[model samples]
Target chain A: MSVSIDARGPRWSAAITAVVLATALVTSNLWVIAFQAVVFAIGAIRGPQFTPYALIFKKLIKPRLKSEPILEDVRPPQFSQAVGLVFALVAVIASITGAGGVFTIAVGFALAAAFLNAAFNFCLGCQMYLLILRVRTAK
Target chain B: MPDVHYAHIDAESHLELVRKLDIRSTPTTLFLNSAGVEVGRAMGTPKRAQVQAAIAAIH
Candidate 1:
């Protein structure tokens, strides 16, 4: 029962939204960005912690409360988030430098990695946390 | 052994609670005795054995 996480739908939806938003940002598609921004704003305004897909999922499905280790609550540094931030910043700089294609590709890769993580739930950022722990403990 | 009942407090609420409890970081396990007095605490993913040892000491 514990292993049967009904997170499939939420995870996939989140992945799709992430991919679409990242692609739009990378490609500089104002329409797509605007659409996603509207959705994100609506969700955030609803509950402050309301993610777009989480809002939808919570509306349609109820989560079965069960006691589990709070490990998921551990907010260690997220590598994907860092990578996304860096890519977004670099993309802006690259646009100024007229290297749009390379910037778009870098953003695409970051978004793809995120989507891959959704499918696998094996976060590169979580791995970074493990690596940092290992290094700190080694010394 | 203290039954570790985890609570998912939001960042803002967590700040308030931590301020009151004097906890500073995540993975902060509060060990309470049967009388609900705090006996020990650990931060950041202390090994299960370490937690058990702490719990055993309290017991």
Candidate 2:
């Protein structure tokens, strides 16, 4: 069965992700990136609805919003979360291996994707998912 | 200004351009010199200093 979700939930999650990534970049904290990786893993494995940020949005933010959110299929965002998980994992591994440049680049890419989603509602990973789907169906 | 010409391509409307450039993401900035040679690239939201440094490197 296809599952739909409040489109705003992913954006809200992305906003929190951007902040967390920016903090990780600024502080150069291995633990912070590691923590975000765990968050991404959870989101990827269990779905975006079960993510910590999504829980915060459901519990704290959604009730405060005045209007109903536009719902979207959860597949794209779930795929996006998986993409984020990959980047976060790469960053975490890079950090653990003391590969600073790789870690920075991975975190930078993740931060950029998150900022785009939060600010412009442009989900790069979602777009990528669509593109892949298109290619697969075309074949 | 400063011997630089800027062109903006709307990725949504210009799918051909996006495909031609192989642009996988939004807010991708490419630094090209006078000869149309790509010198540097910054993806996503780049800091002002990063842009400045990219420009400086090309010059």
Candidate 3:
């Protein structure tokens, strides 16, 4: 049986959210960014259907799209979100400890990944997820 | 518009195909033609025009 993925919504909303999350790092907003990371984690584990971005898309963007969305793997994107969650945790830790170096690296890396996905249509987290899978299978 | 054939794989569930295709990330796209040959791809999330061009190339 095929997994019934909701392919109707705007995929870019996640990227935009990431962009905003990236801003948290710039403005040095820890709790706000931490909250964002948790939200993304919830969205990943629970499903994008529960995401505010998805809701926005469903309400605003999805209606305007002229073509049906191309269905793709649900797991990778979720996994990517999970990866995002981990980075968010790192960001939180870095923030709380006043580890500006780590905070920059962690949040910066996440922001870059998100921005790349949004702007260039490339997902660094997805690659990392696949690599993890390969390692798991190999062992 | 709705005549295209597409399938979304759960990368976690289907590790084999992912490895076979060397798929590294989400929003990765594959454009297959009538004979089941990949014509184009826009990894992450492709623009509408890009996908349309891929479709057109196959036809």
Best by TM-score: 3
TM-score of each: 0.44, 0.69, 0.71
Estimate the lDDT of model 2: 0.82
Best by lDDT: 2
User: lDDT, candidate 2, residue B56?
Assistant: 83
lDDT tens readout by residue for model 2, B1-59:
46767776554455566666666554567899878888888765466798889888877
Candidate 3 lDDT over A32-82, as tens digits, reads: 787778778776888756677777877787778887766655565677778
Instruction: Give the clashing pairs for model 2.
Output: none
Instruction: Give the clashing residue pairs of candidate 1, or none.
Output: A79-A125
- lDDT: which is higher, 1 or 3? 3
| Model no. 3, DockQ | 0.40
What is the DockQ (computed on Cα atoms) for candidate 2?
0.03
Model 1 TM-score (2 dp): 0.44
Q: Give chain B TM-scores in order.
A: 0.71, 0.81, 0.87
Instruction: Provide the clash count, candidate 2.
Output: 0
Error of 1 at A15 (Å): 1.1
Candidate 1 lDDT by residue in tens digits, A9-112: 33444475567757675567645544544544443344212555655555664454342322333232233344445655565566567786866775576566
Model 3: CA > 4 A from native: A1-10, B1-59
